[model samples]
Target: MSKICIVYHSGYGHTERLARAVERGAKSVEGTLVRTLSVDQVETHWSELDGADALIFGTPTYMGGVSAPFKAFLDSTGSRWASQAWKDKLAAGFTNSGSPSGDKFNTLVQLADVAAQHGMLWVSLGLLPRAPGPDGLELNRAGFFLGAGAQSPHGAPEVEAPPPQDLATGFALGARVARAAVRWKIAAGQPPTELATRA
Candidate 1:
């Protein structure tokens, strides 16, 4: 099975909720195992990332950029980049904010740049907007294409924010990445095992 790691930092829980939705979609893939890692705990679970087939990054947008802590985490991966440890790995990202256009797209761009520096392949959300779903919600209400974009109320609980549409977008992005990872491996004659695990 493919192993997918979701590394994130949630300043106020909003981003973490979106990360969970990403995990749900990845785990739904028949031959994939998913793990969520907080940036603060990266050292403890570093091995999981080293062995992952794909990595989905998440963070809350702050000051039109990735959170400070998450930026630190990305910087901390310099060693991995130098070692070429994650080269060619599938990479994707997600970000949360309090406004519909919170410049979270910039955060996603930063993440993609980090992945590129590691020689990783970036995966876009690949969702079409204005495609209505249940409850008349469009597939990507926030209209993000590079990655998932979610908006939570300023001080509201995440469950009551990010809206159902945004969470669904995250879920779809995760599933898309999982599928791509499997395909990439198979194309390389490295069919995944039936089971995978993480710390």
Candidate 2:
């Protein structure tokens, strides 16, 4: 079975909601096991993270980047980076902010950089932006390809913010990562020459 773990920080619960949507999508894939870990809880979940085949990161965008707590969590992975513990693992990220143009892309870049530092493969959102419709609920509405991006109105509760479209986009990201992980696992078991020939 392939294992997927989602690690995230939610300043006001919006990001957490998005993380859950991602978890649901990963679980939709048969033979996949999924888990979600809050940044605060990672101290005790290192083993779980290490065992995952793929990791999906989520965080709130604050001041054009990831929030302080999420940054701390990233920093805490220094030892993992040095050991290349996550090397060859698939990685993906999602972020949410109070405005559509909250410089959220920077947050995704930061997450991708972290994954790169750990020698992990990064997964793109693999979605195209949809024009605004009558209900304004369109997947990839924010037009970000690096990772999933979501906008939550200021002061809006988690249930109301990150509307259905962004959540759906997050789900797609998770499913994509999970599928990639499964394929990667299968490839890893093949002979080097066989893999090269297929490539």
Candidate 3:
């Protein structure tokens, strides 16, 4: 079975809700085991993270970048980077902000950089942005290709913000990462000669 872990930091409930949506999507894939870990809980979940076939990261974009807490979590993975413990693992990320263009792409770049530093493979959202319908809801509304991007109106409560459309986008990202991880696992088990032949 493929194992996927989602690690995120949610300053408010909005990002946490997105994380749950991602979790649900990852769980939708058969033969996949999913786990969600908040930044605060990472201290005790190192083993789980190390063992995951893929790691999906999520964070709130604060002041044009990743939140301080999420940065801290990324920094804490220094040892993993040093030992290349996460090498060859699949990595994906998602972020939420208050505006449509809150410099959120910078946050995704930072997340991808962390994954690169650990020698992991990065997964794109693999979704196309949709034009807003009459109801003003659409998948990949943010038009982000690096990773999933979500927006919550300023001052809006988590219960109503991010809307259903953004949540669906996050779900698509999760499922994509899980499916990629499964394929990666299968490929890793193949004999080098056979893999080369297929290539």
- Please report, in order, the local distance difference test score of every candidate based on alpha carbons: 0.89, 0.90, 0.92
Which regions of candidate 3 deviate over 4 angstroms? Answer: 131-137, 195-199
Ten consecutive residues with minimal summed lDDT in candidate 3?
Answer: 128-137
Highest lDDT: which candidate? Answer: 3
Model 2, C-alpha of 29: deviation from truth (Å): 1.1
Off by over 4 Å in 1: 156-159, 190-199
Pairing residues by index, what is the TM-score of model 3? Answer: 0.93
Ranked candidates (TM-score, high to low): 3, 2, 1
Predicted structure with the largest TM-score when compared to the true one: 3
> In candidate 1, what are the lDDT values of residues 130-190, reduced to their tens digit?
5566677777887888999898977655347678888888888899999998887777675
| Each prediction's number of clashing residue pairs | 1, 0, 0
Worst 10-residue lDDT window, candidate 2? 130-139
1-199 per-residue lDDT for model 2 (tens digits): 8999999999878899899989988888887899899999999999999999999999999999999999999999999999899999999999999989799999999999999999999999988887343355678889999999998989645457788888888888888888898898898777899667899
* Residue pairs in candidate 1 whose N, alpha carbon or C atoms collide under 3 angstroms: 1-193
Q: Per-residue lDDT of 46-110 in model 3, one digit per residue for the tens? A: 99999999999999999999999999999999989999999999999999999998999999999
